[model samples]
Target: MALRFAILGAARIAKPALIDPLSENPDASLVAIGASTRERALEYAMTHAIPNAGTYEEVIARDDVDVVYIALPPAGHCEWSLKALEAGKHVFLEKPATVNEAEARVLVDAAKKAGKRLIEAFHYRWHPLFRRAVEIVQSGQLGELVSAEAEFSVPIVRNAREFRWQASQGGGALADLGCYPVSWLRQLTGAEPEVTSAHQDLEPDGIDRRTTAHFSFPNGLQADVICDMDPEGGRKPPRLELVGTKGRLDIDNPLAPQYGAELKLTLDGQETRETFPRRPTFAYQFDGIVDAIQSGQPVWTEGADLIANAAAMAAIRRVAATG
Candidate 1:
């Protein structure tokens, strides 16, 4: 039986994150959509070829939906995800899973108690480029990792960026973009790191336009992460850099490697470049989601992993406030 997906909101992210993947995943089907209003849902439904459209509550209660893809704003994520879990539907939530760690804990607990597969959709990690990096690092090919750095930045003008992202509303460089580097470091390191020091650049409204933090992992691998949303700061390639005892690895645009990233590995003074097909990151991610549901396994971004990422983000803010 195909797993039917019902979108929880008419969010802009719904297309690349869920709908497009639904169209490609054989085991998944787009059955319905529930937005803040029926008209909005209906409009989105018509645009996406989804069959049913209605209010949020009505869609969750439908027998046709076995899964709920939540594309709501950060504030609404926790509430709606919990509701979906309580309604006996698996949840695929967007990143920063919740506005804070407290809500993440609650929502994760609810998913566990409900015995449903809850995934925090960190789409970048699912891409082959990132997966290959993980393999190299884990294969001992990286050879006793020494340190690493990952950065994601976009140069949207302040006015354009601030309109939707206020710190109070869970909008900031760190919350919105920093989570990726943090999670990437954690994934590659295979252990949680301590936030040794942190800094933030804020707007008049207290939005963190840029945040930089240093972390020290238990295995003696130190790392740095920078998330910048400053327009004047110019653009940055979505990159991750790793240094090990034997050699170094530099990835250009690792975040969306499908779009193209040059993955270079240098060992013993021999350098080689690796490549993966330019399929969208969501393609691999959606299939993993379906496999998790069918096999009764947790997605990579499920359970403790979700809570850990949320807690790490909170720690970054706390450290920045005190530092």
Candidate 2:
């Protein structure tokens, strides 16, 4: 039996990357979609051939819908996720699951009491390119990693209408793009960072426009991440590189919607190259969510990791506020 899903929003980000993949998954069925407006919901439903269209409450209440994907803005994650889980549906919430650690704890508690599965939609983790990166780094081929750098910067959508430009909506480069680089650092090294130093520029509305974070771990490994919503494109690129005692690895398009990409691993200190493609990987995480629901298996980016991320962001926000 396929897991029936009802999306809580007709968010534009869902269309090409998220919704398409969920549709292609044989074990998952896109049964319904809910939007703020009934007419808009119905129109999208008809266009996508979805079985049902209604408000979020109505869709989550439906008995046939086994799962709910909450793709709303960052600020709405906790409310919608808790509501869906209380309604006896597994929840797949978009990244930065909640605005802070306290909210995430509330969510984890709710999921525990209800015996339902709750997952943060960090899609990049599901991609094989990242898995391969972790494999190579952990294999000691990197020979005792030392320092690394990553950057995810794109043109800022500064239109006053966009939620990202609003502080009340949980908007910022740290929560938006920085989350990816930080999560990658944790996943690849399999360790919590000991020290975090950061600098951020806040917009007039009190949201971060640009951020640079430096993290140091216990094993003498260090990493730097820069996430900016305002940039001229050429100065910064969306890439991640890992350097170790042995060599370095360069990954372009670190967060591609698709699971495949070119990875270069250099060894022997001469820029010797090995090219590998990361593919057939998205299903790994999808299956993980199902197994966690059915068999009570533990999940990968859970409570502690979520807390660490929020704490780091909190620190960054403090720095921004002080400046």
What is the model-wide C-alpha lDDT for candidate 1? 0.87
Per-candidate TM equals 0.96, 0.90
- Could you say which candidate leads in lDDT? 1
Question: Which regions of candidate 2 are displaced past 4 Å?
Answer: 234-236, 257-260, 270-296
Cα lDDT for residue 257, model 2? 30
Candidate 1 segments whose C-alpha is farther than 4 A from its true place: 157-164, 231-233
For residues 52-135, write the lDDT of model 1, one tens digit per residue: 999999999998899999987687888889889999999999888998899989998998799888899998888888888889
Question: lDDT tens digits, residues 92-199, model 2?
Answer: 887888888788888988988888888887767766677778888888998988998888887656687677778888878888888888788888888877546778
lDDT of each: 0.87, 0.77
**Which 10 residues in a row give candidate 2 its minimum summed lDDT?**
273-282
Error of 2 at 39 (Å): 2.3
